[model samples]
Every structure is written in structure tokens, then in C-alpha cells.
Target: MKYFIKVVLAESYKQHRNYFNNKMIYVSLFLWPLLSFLASYYSYKAFDLEESAISYINSGNILVFLLIGYMAMSFFRSVVQSAWRFSSERQSGTLEYIYLSPASRLAVLMGNALSSVFESSVVMLVFGILMIFYNRESLHANVVGLVVVMPIYVIMALLWGVFINACFLYSRDTDFLFTILEEPMEIFSGVKVPVMIFPGWAKLLSCIFPLTYALEALRQVTLNNSDLGTIKITVLISILIIVVLLAATLITIHIVEKHVRKTGNIILF
Candidate 1:
């Protein structure tokens, strides 16, 4: 137990130092998300949100609404992109060395996910909080609800990253996951749009991403003052997703330990 904790701490420190060493990286993280957010906010300007199909959104609360979605997304996105960076381990042969070391693989993976998610989201999370509080007239969450749901939201993102990292670790050619998960998650996870009005087919597809559930619970708490009891089903589903992700992460890590990647890609004609 002590060693596991030590590994997690060491791995977390290493990830923060290695990737987050540059102050510009933090600025870019803030800038890119802020830019994407501004673009989305403006696009909705033409629409009459008062007459819009979605009940919770309005001109007054739109900024807070969108900020929450993007804030939550930063957590999930950071982890997925960071996990793909596990490829660096494979490329440097450090992955094999780490495997040979006595450290617990799961602990190391969790540490990496933890550091990435926290650093990636902290900037936006703080910004969102200030905005939400500034727009507190539009905000309506219970303190108890925020206390309960916020941890669930963080856990879901962490586990989601861990699951993705484990799958990427299974083989060298899994880079396609980065392609499939990154853009598609932002699109399908109801980050900018409400799932309520989505077509049945789209709704079914959205369920595949855990962010959909996290965002639902999140928006409800912030915009509707939804307490745990009110969002219990969403909370339940988030818990179930977290459990499934943890199990999948462990299973994938085991498989990854025994699997070996072959050298060289296909030769171009």
C-alpha cells in the first residue's frame, strides 16, 4: 500500500514536471478552450434562446452554461490526449522498462491521469466558478448537491482517462483512438448542445460517452439547483460507468503486460 502511494505520487510529480513545465502550455490550454468557447457563444447569438427548444438556456445564463460544459470537457480531453502520449513510452522503450519495474501499473496509470486532469481543468474550473458565481442569479445549485456531484464528476473523468490509457497501452497502433475519441466526444457528449432535443439515434450514440452523463448532472446542479435526490438516476449511471471503467482499465492493463508490439509499419509504395 505504501509503495503504491509512493508510485502514484512520484508518477504524478513526473507528469506535471515533464508536460506542464512550460508556462506557455498553460496559457495555450486556456487560450484554445477560451477561443473555442467564444466561437460557440457567438454562434448562438443569432438564435433566439428565449424561444429556443431547450428550457435551461437563455441569453443571461448562456455563458455560464457553456463554461460548465467546456470546463468538464477539459478534464476528459486532457486525460485522453495525455493517454495517447503513452505512445512516447512505447517509442522510448520506457514502457517495457516500467513493466519490468516493481511499481504497480495501475497506480502509475492513475497518477498520470490524476495529474493531467487536475492541471488541465484547474484553470477552466476556476474561471467557470467565478463566472457562475458572478451569474449567481442564474445559478441555483444546493451546496449539498454541489458537494456530492462535483466529486462524482471528477471521478468519472479520471476513470475515463485511465480506461483510455490502458487500451492505448495494449498495442502501438492504437493511435486511432485519439482520432475517434477526441473530436467525437466533444460533438456527442452534449458539450455545447442539449441531449434532450437530439434525435433518438443521436441520443443513443451520445450515451456511449460518459461525459454526456457528467454534463447532464452538472448542468442540472448549476442551472436547476438539482439536488442529489433529483439527479439520483444520473448519479447512479455515473457510478455504474465509473465502476465499468475501473474494471476495464484493470483488465486492459493485464493484457498489455503480456502483449508485445512488433517493429515497423507498412512500407509505402
Candidate 2:
């Protein structure tokens, strides 16, 4: 138990010091999402939201609604970008040495994920909270639901990062994974739009992302003031996603190790 805790902490410290050594990173992290959020919010001004299909959207609550979506998105999106960044480990030749270490590989991955979650979205999260407070009048949130769901939201993002880190372990050329996931997650996960308003095929694609479920439940509780019972299905789906990702991460780590031993190479292809 002590060794595992040490491994997690050591990896977390390495990740933090190696990539997030500068204070300016926090400012940049907040700015990117803020720009995206502004662009998205302004684009809606050209339309009449009251006439929109989604029942909850209106001029009054639109600002806060969008804030919640973007805030939830930051948690999941930052982790994806972090995993993609970690791919450079192969180029640096540190990944092989880390794999050769005596520590548990899973602990190393978890630690990386943990570090990603803590720093990547913090600035954005704080900004979002202040904005939400400003527009508190526009919200209809369930206090209990928000309290319960917040931890799950972070855990889901952490597990997602771990799963993505495992997948990126296969190869150095992981730009394709970055390309496919980042934009698609933003679009299909209903960050700027609601899944309920999406076309049939688009809705089907949205279900493929765990972000879709997380954001949906988040909006349900925050915008609609829905209770735990009302969002039981979404919560169940999130739990299932968490379980599947944890198992897949473990399996992928085993595969990565085997491939390294057999080929004496860390890069899969």
C-alpha cells in the first residue's frame, strides 16, 4: 500500500514539474476555454433561442446553461489533451525507462491522470464558478444533486485520462487519436448544443462519448433542478463507463508491456 501511494505521488510530481513548471500555463488554460465559450455564446445571439427545440434554452438561462456545459467539458477535454501530450514521452525515450521501472505501471498511469485533472482545468473551473455565481439568477440548480455529481464528474474525467494514456502507449504517431477525439468530443458531446436537439444519426454518435452522458446529467441537474432519481439512468451509464474504462486501462497496460518485451520496442507501430 505504501509503495503504491509513493508511485502515484512520484509520478504525479514528475508530471507536474515536467510540464506544468510555469505559472503562466494556468492563465493560458483559462483563456482558451474562455475564448471558445465566448465564441459559442455569441453565435447563439444570431438566433432566437426561445423558438429553439430544446425546452430549457431561453435568453434568460442561456448564459448559465452554456457555462455548465463548457465547465463540464473542460474536465474531460483537458485530460484528452494531456494524454496526447504524454505521447511525446516516446520521442523523449523516457516511456521505455518508466516501463522498465519496478513500480506498478497502473499507478504511474493513474498518477499522470491525477495530475492532469488537478491543474489543467482549474483556472477554467474557477472562472466558470464566478460566472455561474454572476448569473445565479439564470440557474435552477439542485444543491444536493450538484454536490453528489461533482465528485463523480471529476472521477469520470480522471478515468478517461487513464484510458487515453493507455491507448497512446501503443504508438508515437498518436496525432490521429488527438484529431479524432478532441473536436468530435466537443461537437458530439453537446458542449455547445444539446443532444436532445441533435438529428438521429448525430444522437447515435453522441452516445459513444462518456462526455455525452456526463454533460447531459450535469445540465439536467443544474438547468432543470432535477433530483437524483430523475437522472438515475444517466448516472448508471456513467458508472458503467467508469468500470469499462478502468478494466480497459488495466488490459491495455498488460498488452503494452507484452509488446515491449517481445519487440524490445515501446512503440507499437
Candidate 3:
């Protein structure tokens, strides 16, 4: 257990150093989200949605609604970033060294996932604070509910990252997978709009993505002032999804490791 803790911390420290050492990453972190948020806000305004529609989607505070949705999207995007990092490790030859280590592979992967979450949370925090300052009037929520829900939300997002990383273990290239998943996830997960407004087919797609539940639970708690009890169904679904993804990730890692052992190569292709 102590060794696992050490690995997590060591990995987190490495990520922390890498992130802070590069000034542009910090700039891009703040700039890209801010730009995207503004673009989304103006685009929605151009549609001139009815006040009732806005209220249904975001409690009538489009700024805060978009802010929270974008923040959640950013958090999930970090998981993809972690997968990209895992792929990069393979390309750089460091992945083989890590695989050869005596440490548990699950622990190493968990460490990487946790580190990505940590970094993403920092960026989200900064953007969230800025949004709050800029649109304080748009903010209305049960603060206590948000506090309770956020930890679980972060865990669910990290589980997604671990699952994606596991999938990449068997692939030589992740670009196609990332490309296919990224936009659909953003659109179907309610990052730019409410899932309630989605078409029937889109709603079905939302059911397949765990981010849908996360965003539902989030908006329920933070925007609607609902307690955990009120969103129990969504929370339960999120937990179930996390469990299933974790199981799949474990199975994938086991299969990949066995193949690597037999073939004596990390990259099958």
C-alpha cells in the first residue's frame, strides 16, 4: 500500500513539474476554455432561446451553466490527455521500462490517471473561479451538494481515463479513436447544451456515455439545488458505469500484459 502511494505521488509530482515548467500550457489552459466558453455563450445567444428554455437548460444563467458544463468537459478531456500520454510513453520507449518495473501495472496506470485528474482539477478550479467572478449573478446552487458530488464525479472521470488508457495498450495509434470519441462525447454528454434538448437518437447515445450521468447529477445538484437523495438514480448509474468500466479496464490490461509476455513486445503492431 505504501509502495502504491509512493508510485502515485511520484507520478503526480512528475506531472506537476512538467505542467508548471511550461508556461504556455498554463496560458493555453486558461485561454482555450475561456475562448470556447465565450464562443458557446454567444452562439447560444444568437439562437435567442426562450427564457423558459434557458431556465430548463441552465437555471436561466447561461454563463454559469455553460461554465460548469465546459468545466466538466475539460475534466473528461484530461482523461483523453492521459491516454495520449500513455501512447506517447510507448512511442518514447519509456512504457516498456515502466512495464518491466516490479511495481503493479494497475497501480502505475492509476497513478497516471490520478495525476491527470489532479492537473485537470487545477485548470478547472482556475476557470471556475474566473467564471464565478464574472457571472456571480448566474450562480445559484446548493454549495453543500456540490461539495458532496464533486469527489465522486472526479473519480468517475478518472475511471474513464483508466479505461481509455487500457484500450490504447493494444493499439499502435490512438489518433483515430480519440478523434471519433472526442466530439461525440462533448455533444452527447451535454457539454454545450442540455441532454433534455437532445433528439431521441442523441439521447440514446447519451445513455452509452457515462459523462451523461455525471453531467445530469452535476446540474441536478449544483444548478437545481438537489441533494444526493434527490439524484440517487443518477448517482447510482454513475457508480455502476464506473464499476463496469473499471472491470473492462482490468480485463483489457490483463489481456495486453499476457500478449506482451508472449510476444516480448509492448506494441503488437
TM-score of each: 0.94, 0.95, 0.90
Report the lDDT tens digits of candidate 2 across residue range 1-269: 88998998998899999989999998988898899999999999999998988877898888888888888888888888888878878878888789878889888888888888878888888988998898888888888988877777778888998888888887666568888888899999999999998999999999988889988888888888899999989998998898998899999989877877887767442
RMSD of each: 2.9, 1.6, 2.2
Tens digits of lDDT, candidate 3, 66-118:
87888888888877777776787777787788888887777777778887776
If the candidates were sorted by their TM-score against the true structure, best first, what order would they fall in? 2, 1, 3
Global lDDT of each candidate: 0.86, 0.86, 0.77
Question: What local lDDT does model 1 show for residue 92?
Answer: 71
Worst 10 residues of 2 by lDDT: 260-269
Candidate 1 residue spans exceeding 4 A from truth: 261-269
Model 2 scores what on Cα lDDT? 0.86
Better of 1 and 2 by TM-score: 2
Q: What is the lDDT of residue 138 in candidate 2?
A: 81
Error of 3 at 168 (Å): 1.1
